[model samples]
Structures are given as structure tokens and as C-alpha cells.
Target: MLVDSHCHLDHLDLSDYQNSLDRLLDTARQRGVTQFLSVGVDLPSSSRLVELAQTRDDMLVSVGVHPLQRESPPLPEVTELLSLGSQPGVVAIGETGLDNYYDKDNAEWQEQSFISHLQAGAQLRKPVIVHTREARAQTMAILRDYASTSSGGVIHCFTENWDMAKAAMDLNFMISFSGIITFRNASALREVVKKVPLENMLVETDAPWLAPVPYRGKQNEPKYVVEVAKAVAEIKGVGWQQVAEVTTANFQRLFLP
Candidate 1:
């Protein structure tokens, strides 16, 4: 069985699925995607994710604002993050971290939000789901300062050097690969995947985006995580089945009850 370690379920374009979330998930199930972590990027999405997971045994969730998300009046505070993350079925604290690649001028706000989410994760004893891009140093520094070994997290959609990957592993963070790893231009990322231990790796589609090759430029779904697994298997010189078993286990070990 495969687990989509990260996805934005609410953002999926379900037009072809008769606008039915169940239908989309049914398609994923047929592809051996047995479980999903529907990630949240902000307060509203987090609330929606909690509602979505409430009745689905196979679905779990993470809550926090994305680093690039502009802080609005409704942006969750540290206490609010703690409260939401404490809710049942909320297995992780964030899809949070710094992203200087997008908006360098807002570094201060991003750091504030990132630090708050880390604090919430630390306090609630829940793992965080991090998203770092072009801000590796700041991201690792914040994580090293706040993320305890007991409340470790994963760096989602990793597209970084081996140095960054090693730094994250040192902090007890698993490195999750998305379809981006399957791109022809992602050779460096592929090398990082090769070096990361199987026990410390996870796979995701980040569905509704970053669809793997053969499905690239089309809408992505959890079903396509198998392609990512297949790629990782090839990179690590292991069988695809081994990738499936190990990543599923890693997801459960890190985020499941």
C-alpha cells in the first residue's frame, strides 16, 4: 500500500470526477493509495482539512500557514495553532517554513509565522510538515532551534542539495520527495534521494500540482504517487515494492496514531 504523505485535497480540481471528492479518492484507492495526508496551507484550509478528515479513517491532516501565504487578519496565532493541532486527526503542525525565492521582502513575517508553527509543534508534541525553498539556511536554523527530536517533522517536496538534506536528517526530519524528483532537470534532487536512507524517506504527489512525468502538465492525484515511488526505487537501486512498503511505514511511523 502507498500513502500520499502530503497533498492539498481541497484544492483539487474535481471537475472530471463529477465534482466529487469520493470519486477522486476511489480512483486513488484503485491505484493502491490506501491513505492520504490532506495538508493545509492556512487557517481556512486547516479548518476545512479537519472537517474533511473527521469521518475518513484513511485520511489525516496537518495545520499551518504556508510560508508564502500573506498574513491576514485571520492568520492563526501560535496559541490558535496549538489549539487546532491538538485536535484529533491533526497529526502534524505545519506545511510551514521559509521561502525567500518567492518574496524576499517579507522575510520578517515569514520567520515569525514559521517560528510560531514550530513552537506549536514543539508544545503539542506533533511533527511539523515543512516546505523550504531557497531559504535553506534560515529554515534549518529555525528547525534546529525549535524542533525537538521527540517532535520531529518532514521536509515536504524537497528540491535541495545533499547538504540541506543531511542537515534536515541531522535534526531528525524525514525528507519527502514529490513528483518534482521525476523531472529531467531534477538530477541534483535525484542524487539527494539516492543518499537519503530508506528509513528517512517519504513520497507524496502534492496532488493537484507537480504531477509526475507521463502525467506531467496535467492535474495530479494521489494515484500518481506510484510513479514517484518507482523513480525513488530506481534511484536507490531497490525494487518498487520496497519503496512502497518503506514509505508507507515511514508515514505511519511519523504521523499516524
Candidate 2:
């Protein structure tokens, strides 16, 4: 089985599936993507995901305010995060971290929110689901300071260098590769994939976005995670089933424990 470790099910264009989440998930299951982590970008979305996961044994959820959510006033406080994060079926603390690529102006706010999520994760003993971009150095520093090694986490949709990957892994975090790795211009990212050990790796589609090649430009879905896994297998010089087995094992170890 394969797991799409990061996806926005609520944001998906489910029209093709008759606007049904169940139909969408059935398609993914048919493609061997049997598990999903529907990440949240804000409080309302987190609440929705929690509700969605409650009845689905194949689904898990993460609660947090994404760093780019400038509209979320007053930043995210540890108390607020703890309250939502403590819910059952909520296996992780964030789709949180710094993202300077899109909005460098909100760096301070992002850092504060990131720290709060890390604090909540540390307190709750749940792993974090980090979404970092152009702010690698700061992201690493904040994680090193606020994140607990025992709680751990995964650097979702990783597109950084080996140094950052090594640093995150050293902190007991897994590095997840998204469908971006399958793009023709992502040769550099594929190189990074080659160096990352399968034991510390995970695969995701980040669906409703970043659909893998052959499905690029189309609305992404959890079903496309198989393509991401196939890409990883090619980059790692391993069989596709082996990549699926290892990544599924890694996901269970980090999120299902």
C-alpha cells in the first residue's frame, strides 16, 4: 500500500468524482494508494479534517495554521494548537513551518506560528508535518530549538538540498517527496532523492496540486501518489513495491504509532 502523506482533500476539485470525497478516495484505493493524511491550513480546515477522519480508518489528520495564512489573526498560540491537536485521529501538529518563497514580508509571523506548532507537538507527543520553503536555515534553526526529537516529524514536500535533508533526519524527521520529483526540470530534486535513504523517506502527491508527470497540469489526487512512489523507486534504484513497502512502513512508524 502507498500513503499520500500530504494532501488537501477539502480543497480538491471533486467534481469529477461527483463531488464526493468517498468516490475520490475509492479511486485512490483502486490505484493502491490506500492511506492519506489530509493536512489542514487553518483552524476551520483542521476541524473539518478531524471530522472527516473520525469515520475513516484509512485517513489521518493534522491540525495547524499554515505559515502563509496571513489572514489568521494574532498568530497561532500554543494553547489554541494544543486544544485542537489533542483531538483523536489528529496524528500530527502541522502543515506548518516557514515559507519565504511566496511571502517574505510575513517572516516574523510565520516564525512565531511555526514555533507555537512545534511547542504544541512537543507537548502533545505527536509528530509535526512541516512545510518549509526558501527559508531552510531559519526552519532548521527553529526546529532544532523547539522540536522534540522523540516526537519527531516529516519535512513534507521536500525540495531542498542534501544538507537540509541530513539536518532534518538528524533531528529524527523523515523527508517526504512529492510529485514534484517527477517533473522533467526536477533533476536536481531527483538527485537529492537518490541520496536520501529509503528508510527515512515518504511519498505524497500534495493533491489538488503538484500532480506527477503524465498527470501534470491535471487536478491532482491521492491516486497519483503511486507515481510519486514509482519516481522514488527509480531514483533510488529499487523496485516500486520495495519503495511502497518502505515508505508505508515509515509512515506507520511516524504517524500511526
Candidate 3:
């Protein structure tokens, strides 16, 4: 079965009616995604992830702040994150990192918070779900500073050039392509995905956000990760099964710790 390495299943407006998680999970499972990584962007959401994970063995979780949170920088102690990390399905330490694209004014805060999460991940020995946007050099520097060579993480929603991809890989980080890889204008990113080693590659939807081609401009969800897998397979000239197995194994090794 495939694994969705990152998805914001809790946010994204799953309000009163139609598209319930039951249906979404069933669709994903039917499409070969049996496991999921539900990422938490803040305290309330992190608590929700813990609660969500408690209900299912297949659901794993990551806890941290989105770089833009005005919530005093999510400086939760290592002990607190470790306490949560010790729980049954808490697998990773972030949806955290630099987001210079979104919150330019808070760049300093973002840098500081990113370091804190990296340290927590280092101490807890959990793979961090790193998010870098328009700040590749800074992101790499901080990661290299705080993260040991052994404690690598995933570059989630990777849309950068192969040079950036190579740099992340050099630090032992995996590059995860999200649904954006399927877009027509994402040709450059598709090329990057092709050059990346399958052994250090993964796929995600960054769901509740960048849905793939046919589904772009709408709400995204985890199940669409298969479409990303399909795009990556075509780019890499590999079979869909190979993408499934390799990325799933990458997920297990990194997030499962």
C-alpha cells in the first residue's frame, strides 16, 4: 500500500456536509494509499492529530508550528515534544521550517522557530517535516547547523531546482514532490524530480492545498498523492509500483524512526 507522507486533513474546511474522512480514506485506500501522515501546524491542531492518531494504526503524525503562526513561535520544550513523540503514532517533529514566501516580516521569528524545531527533532531523533519557500540558502544553513548528518528530514512540497534538491540530499534529506509536480507549468520541477535518485525521493499531495493538474485550484486531500506518484513514475521512467514501494519505504524509515 502507498503512504501519504504529508496532509493537513484536520484543517481545509471539512465542514458540516459531504466529503467526510471516511470517504476520503476509503478512496485513498482503494487507490493504494493505506497509511497517512497527518501533520499538525499548531497546538490545537497538534492535539487534534494526537486524537486522530489514537483512532487508527495507519495514521501517523508530526507536530510543530507553521512558520507563520503568531503564537509566540511554538517554543514547546523538547520534553513536551518528546512526551508527544513517545505516543503511539507521533512520528515526526514538524510541518516547520522557513516560509519566507508567506511571512516576510516574520523572517527572523521563522528562523528562530525553525532552529527550535530542528533541535527538538535532533533530541527526539525524529525526522522533521521541513517547509522551505523562497529561502533555500537559509533553510539549508539552519538545517546543517542544527541537524546532525544522521538526523535528516523531508523537504516537503519540493518545487525547487535540482541544485536545491541535490543540496538537501547532500544533507541526507529526502525530496518529496507534491501535486504541484503534475501541473503544466511545473515542467522545471518535473525535470528536477526526474534527476533525483529514487532512493532519496518521495511523493506527497500537501493536501488541503496544491491538488494535482485536473484537481488544481480546488481543495486538495491526501488521496491525490497517487496522482503525484503517477507523475513521478512517468518522470523517472519507472513503474507506479516502484514509486509506491520506494516512497512507502522512505516514509517508514524516516517517519517511523
Pick by lDDT: which candidate is best?
Answer: 2
In order, candidate lDDTs are 0.90, 0.92, 0.84
What's the true lDDT of residue 81 in model 3?
A: 66
- Candidate order (lDDT): 2, 1, 3
Assess the local accuracy of residue 117 in candidate 3 as a C-alpha lDDT between 0 and 100: 83
State residue 235's C-alpha deviation in candidate 3, in Å: 1.0
TM-score for each of the candidates: 0.97, 0.98, 0.94
Give the better candidate number (1 or 2) by TM-score. 2
- Listed per candidate, the RMSD to the true structure in angstroms reads 1.1, 0.8, 1.7
Instruction: Report the lDDT tens digits of candidate 2 across residue range 1-257.
Output: 88889999999987888989999999999988888999999998999899988889989899999988988768888998899999989999998999989999998899999999999999999999999999999999999999999989999999999999999999999999999998899999999999999999999988899989999889999999999989899888889999999999999999888
Local accuracy of candidate 3 as per-residue lDDT tens digits, 232-255: 999889998899999999888887
Clash-forming residue pairs, model 1: none
Better of 2 and 3 by TM-score: 2
lDDT by residue (tens digit), candidate 1, 85-152:
98889999888898989889988888888889889998888899999889988998888888877868
10 residues in a row with least lDDT, candidate 1: 67-76
After the best TM-score superposition of candidate 1, give how far the Cα of residue 200 lies from its true spot, in angstroms.
0.4
Worst 10 residues of 3 by lDDT: 11-20
